[model samples]
Target chain A: MDKPLNCTIKNPVNLTLGDIKVDMLCGCKVVDITFPNIMSPEVGEIRFKNFYVATLTVKAKYRTENTPRHTGDQPKWKTCLKRVKLMPDPHSEAGSHDYISLTSRQFRCELSNITGLRLILHQPSPVWREFKLEELRLFRSAGGPKTSPLPTWLLEEPKAKVQKKTVQRVASSTPKGGEGGVPDLDGLSANLQQLWALAEEVSTSQTSQSLGRFEVDGCYDINLLAYT
Target chain B: MAAERRKAIPSTSDDNKPLDSDKQFLERTNVNAVVRDVLGKIIANRPEDPVTFLADYFEALVEEQSSLVQRALRVITMTHHSRPVFEVNVRDSYNLLSKHKVNKKLKGVNGSVYTELLQALCRNLPSSVTIKLVQKLECFEHEAVPYDVFRSSIFACCVLREYAFIAEQLFASLDIQKIGKADKALCDAVMDQLKTALGSSRNDVRRIIESSYNLAPEGLHQALERALSREQTQGVCTSEHFITEACDSFLAKVKKLK
Candidate 1:
């Protein structure tokens, strides 16, 4: 919605992409989407929800940091996907609100470090007045967290800091099956650990109370207060 | 009663002579005052089933007579009044839904519990809001329903009444971080659709209220349609402001359509 769209029918075309009057729109339009600082995702894939487009072409501008020539330079747009058929019928309500996912596997170029995306939408039907890509979102690869970068172990190259001969590996002894052995209790809190240690003693001393007898101390004859 | 208790305890020891220890036991127990309080309630309320009432009363008394710290905490948390208090809002509904037993993998809760929660929450809201909410629930009495069904129904209730503020609060409370931002984005997208639809034919709104509120006689739809057309003719901007105004006019028409 950063730039105004020249809609054919509506005087002031709706800027929001959430909902668009399908009948009002005519011919082809190229929409450039620049991500805000908060959600400027490194593109690994794209998902389109509730779309009714005949064909969609995708282009990406990757924010390259390694290259000195690309720094502070104009966006070098590269077409990653070309003329993918989203829906068989753009005019009909069939597949009008279908979800579509375009992964890096479908794209020709690597979708790393994508800061911006361009969608070329082509629809040539006058029958519908309300059509829109109800939602558009970018996501990182499934191998790592979507919002955060890859784990350090995965990203960083291996370094052989320790000498192999000096390294000592301690082998844990097998636990005894009998009552005395302290079993390995993983993920238990310190309080829970102490409780587990005391459980045997506690169970031995504990006794179930008499269900029928309701008494004050040992006295059966006593006045009881009314319940509120 | 203390004198009587002293006599009763002495009879268990020696027949004629009363022991000093038996007298002390009677004095220590404070039996008379407790009996008096119970008698006072029995006389006042005059419950039909005295034994059952006494059982419940004693059970509650035992619970209240816990440790001093526990009693203080109970006082802070529990309502002092005898009657249960009801809250009329989506947050309360959300809290109830969350606390209800659910199978995590299946994403479903007991359907009856869910319906009861919805009914309790919508008790004080407008009839139109409640009816729409009930219809949107789409949950059977005995079958289990997915978690999102409850969330969407609550949102529908808020939207029908144009309580956008409450809807936002509801969204914030029920939002699952694991699902990422898509759920919230979809919610916003749908709300935006409603706002946008208000400008055009208002067919969406008409479709929504096609099944009118109870007591909203026939021609209620026509009246609402006329109101919407009149509002449009007056040139109210078809944006966020118009949505609010349109909802108000729509509600007003519903009220007077009879």
Candidate 2:
């Protein structure tokens, strides 16, 4: 979502990967998820601001972060990483391709209508790493494009600094667990470090309850692999 | 009439001597009547430690006078008035209560504890019971339930959030066919809550909406979809708006996910 997508995501799409165990949310506290989508159906109709959009196939992989311990007695957890992909339903949008290569490679949907688009955008797609503009190319769609050293989106990179934590627990209380203390960076992930900056902003918002936490352990792993 | 002691206790007067409202207790033949008596007492007594009194009240029941034990509980739980208070005071009593099954056979007799507990369960009421009421007010559909059961169902839904199996059991008890179609109130609640909490930024709105959309219906779901669409224009939701954004983002992600 930070960069321009090549295609339009006009409609809602349902694409799935593995072990997700999705269910149609049922009853009282169960939130409503569109039945078709919940059942892993192929069609989607997304609307924003009361405007109905097109339907497509949207595949997502659920991701999280927590460097799972490689061995036991260490008590580890898997930080699921997810990447989302958007494509025109091949059944609906494409035919047997004369160009084998285009057909073989998966499609990326670039939404032409950006009026009211919402992608959680926190995580990246499996195809995302491939989409990074590494060399910073400035070419137009048909190759008759203007050249520039920096792409249009570049403003200024912020100054980078290493921050330190003076985690002073209450003097009276002992650490909660057996491994009384954690290595400072053991649970920290790149995304969490970023959220830490957001946490600073939350403290200034004048709210009674602290909605955001300084806990970087879970978020880091999810964001690291997904948001990168 | 009877001051017969079941077990030895210090406050013999409160236990043995009939309360000023003894006439009402004598008239109580079923659980609802007992519930009315206990609720009236709690509302009137308004004791800081009603739970303790309730426990003492239940423990004081004798074999012949055992009706008092279940009767007092019936009064505490029915009408949804003092159940929480009762639960808090006799915190362990909830476990005991959930385990007890009310027998339906005893109705007109003096010791109709069975009929009493059943009536006190707040079931078969004509109006929509709260527990079932909320369940029936669906983004989808739910019904076939009662108030106390509905209240517990909501909590049950929340508690089983991490487990799929538990979620299934929670759904099974719902008044599914009775629940209506999508609701606009959900949309209003979500949008209003988000706007109040996170401001009008599109990204912030989306985060806010997503935060509550899993619990919304109809137009609010529409609003959330709108918020998600606005992300590109406003930029991804910033951390300052994380509260609204994180949840909206998660909900949108889960829905669009394959």
Candidate 3:
């Protein structure tokens, strides 16, 4: 759709520790990119320029009360993607410069309350002189329509439903037609009413069958497994 | 002999010290040896019900000199002395893979079955092993994979993990006749990749390989040399094929030690 890139990146938070813009990351096995005190509830997509790495593993850390803790800090680091091959052939220079986008669906855990991301870059061959990803960015939306349109039935008023019921009652009171080719609408409405009554009776019987008690009418000697 | 053994029972009035007659009875019946043998079987098998196990044990003892107990005892002793080495039972792996219902006309296993087979086989092994194996197979895009591909992919993973002993056993169990050939250049290339992947843990992997297969330092070197130099074929060697040959050579070295 040729949507604009980085349009939803509001207030890109810097590193929690340092202020350096460009760092020499040669010979480094692991690098971390983090955003401190992010206000977004969820991240829609993440994109980064690839470097000379055979395999790039993406791990995410988030703060969650649902996860139990024994002796650690409030939010702990957890693994998301154990291994992701960014550059298929590390020895070759084909896909080394391409930008890779990881959507929220790709992440193993929920992308909310995300504190940091760890990028583990590995080059299985020693031929690469330098390796590091660049231009890392996270967006709140993927530049597509957020939700589908509501169905037409959901937008109708309550008066329409009352009109439908009144039409069915009128059809049921009408007499049969003389022409044999025409279908009987009166008989059809009567059968539909009978079916609806049967369904309601079954549902009420199910609800009344259970009393949530072990004894029947205060008699503890009753056999629970008895059929009748 | 039974009469003589029974006569040695001591009186209840005596304390912990066994009388001479009681000692003689125990010695004649070999009570210690019999008890040790039975207990060893019970511990090794670990049945759900101990009382039922004991009843069956006594029943077996009555029917021909307790040969079953002696066999079970042998298994226990052998396992105790050796490291619990992994064996690739292809029949068992195939049985597990085939248990999931799939279309016979498809001529391959379902993708979920393939993943489950890898997980089941790689249990107790490193998680990286399964991850690497899945990536190496490159069959995630396919709806189904042939049986041969699955077998070879598993072997490739073991080789990558430096599990030469396991890889070698899997080769034999899968009845793989020829993994083609690799020249010295191919071996050197594959080894370089492995060295880079392992990084500082290369020595640690070597130590593990040595301990698991009981290989000496010089013996491992000799095996690698033989595997690289002995091949004369000019066939194109993939990384997996080269590693398999190296593991086979390691197995050959182990067999020589025995």
Candidate 4:
């Protein structure tokens, strides 16, 4: 398996902040839209034509392998994977209760196939074939996002989870550069209330992002063009 | 001189105040000396008294270690201003820069200073990996090897926000081998008379063991003989049932050996 690139697409790629798209707390994205037909076997020269964009995620995934045990390197004759409880929320969708320290990392995700591929990055770096991919789609356009650049504020620590009470109290006192900087408090308050008052649908259903479930639906074996 | 010192206690009467002041001065002097000595040792001997250093370190955070209640009082009352100036004489008569940084944030609330400091001291605790490495060191396996009180105090943290790993590392420091010993008979007697630890709160786990006299998994008795055979080979002569039923006894033997 090829090294799957850890991509970070501000999950809600274009969080519509009034008129412009503001990348939320989500990480950068490397997206490519293609016919899903071709698998780039060759890490080739970057020509101007084969450019595409795909949504990205900065998920923690792992690839691992076992090594030949040199009886000398390890302790006496003992071999055990130290186990620890799964952290944070036990029922979190992150999966795996307590992760065991084996010899490798672990986590997996998928990306969808769409046309009009572009790289929405934390920093504007030209997207090329540097990402080691097991299987990847090609793109036609590397047209960057329409947003003005990620304002310096979004890159900071997890924004304080402002509650209604907190919003009321801190609406003024909150440190300058509050999440997404100068977030429309009125808009935020409304979204927050809507999120809280599920009333009926709380038990049965929610949108994929709402439920914290995401998959970039990638389709394969369709004729796709490559844009460097 | 010894007799004079003993007799002095009775005649001193009002000297209690002065004696306490002198004792405080002496302890303060001793700390400066110990730290200078410890710093020298930390440089020369290299990390010998890290835990002792850690203990003494966290101890000073205690406004008063007279007892739990007094320490608790300090927790809520020890003001931020006090913590910075708390280690006044720590400056000592010697040493260039006071390299030791004080946590100006430590708020002392009267009696709870000890507890609060204990919590804050976790900030300085050895990493879990570092602690494990130390535990594995032959030096740490000795008869006088110190237990980490920092690890012990975390049990008080129930919100369980963080530090669970630190909690486990602290609890595992309880040496069963140190508590159980060769003189099983004598150890059992003392253990029987003793009560549970002052801080050991009653919880479901305690209730489970108390209700059934079963401390481990159910249906362990049937496998005791086979289990004991393996355990005995490892120098632990214990049936599953015997060990569970007599944990206090086991701990006593280990403690006695120490």
Error of 4 at A112 (Å): 9.1
TM-score of chain A of each: 0.45, 0.15, 0.46, 0.15
lDDT by residue for model 2 (A28-121), tens:
1101122221222221122222111112222322212333343433432221112222223322323212111111013243322112222321
Q: Which runs in model 2 stand beyond 4 Å of their true positions?
A: A1-228, B1-40, B44-84, B88-258
| Candidate 3 chain B worst ten-residue window by lDDT | B249-258
As a whole number from 0 to 100, the lDDT of residue A100 in candidate 4 is 20
**TM-score, every prediction:** 0.24, 0.17, 0.24, 0.16
First chain TM-score, candidate 3: 0.46
Q: Report interface Cα RMSD per prediction.
A: 31.1, 21.0, 37.8, 28.1
Distance (Å) between predicted and true CA of A100, model 4?
A: 16
Model 4 scores what on Cα lDDT?
0.27
Local accuracy of candidate 2 as per-residue lDDT tens digits, B116-203:
3333342332122223322222221111222233233222222112122222222222212323221233223333433343332335
Candidate 4 has a TM-score of 0.16
Q: For residues B215-256, could you state the per-residue lDDT of candidate 3 as single tens digits? A: 222222333334445556344544345434543332221111
DockQ of each: 0.01, 0.01, 0.00, 0.00
Q: Chain B TM-score for each model?
A: 0.28, 0.22, 0.29, 0.19
Model 4 spans > 4 angstroms off? A5-13, A21-37, A40-228, B1-215, B219-258
**C-alpha-based local distance difference test score of model 3:** 0.47
For residues B1-258, what per-residue lDDT tens digits would candidate 4 score against the true structure?
A: 654565457545565554444445557667657656545633432334467654654575554535433333233222221233312211220111112122464322221332333343333333442232223221211122122221122212211212223222222221233443222332222123222221122353443233222111121121222233344333322222222323222122211110
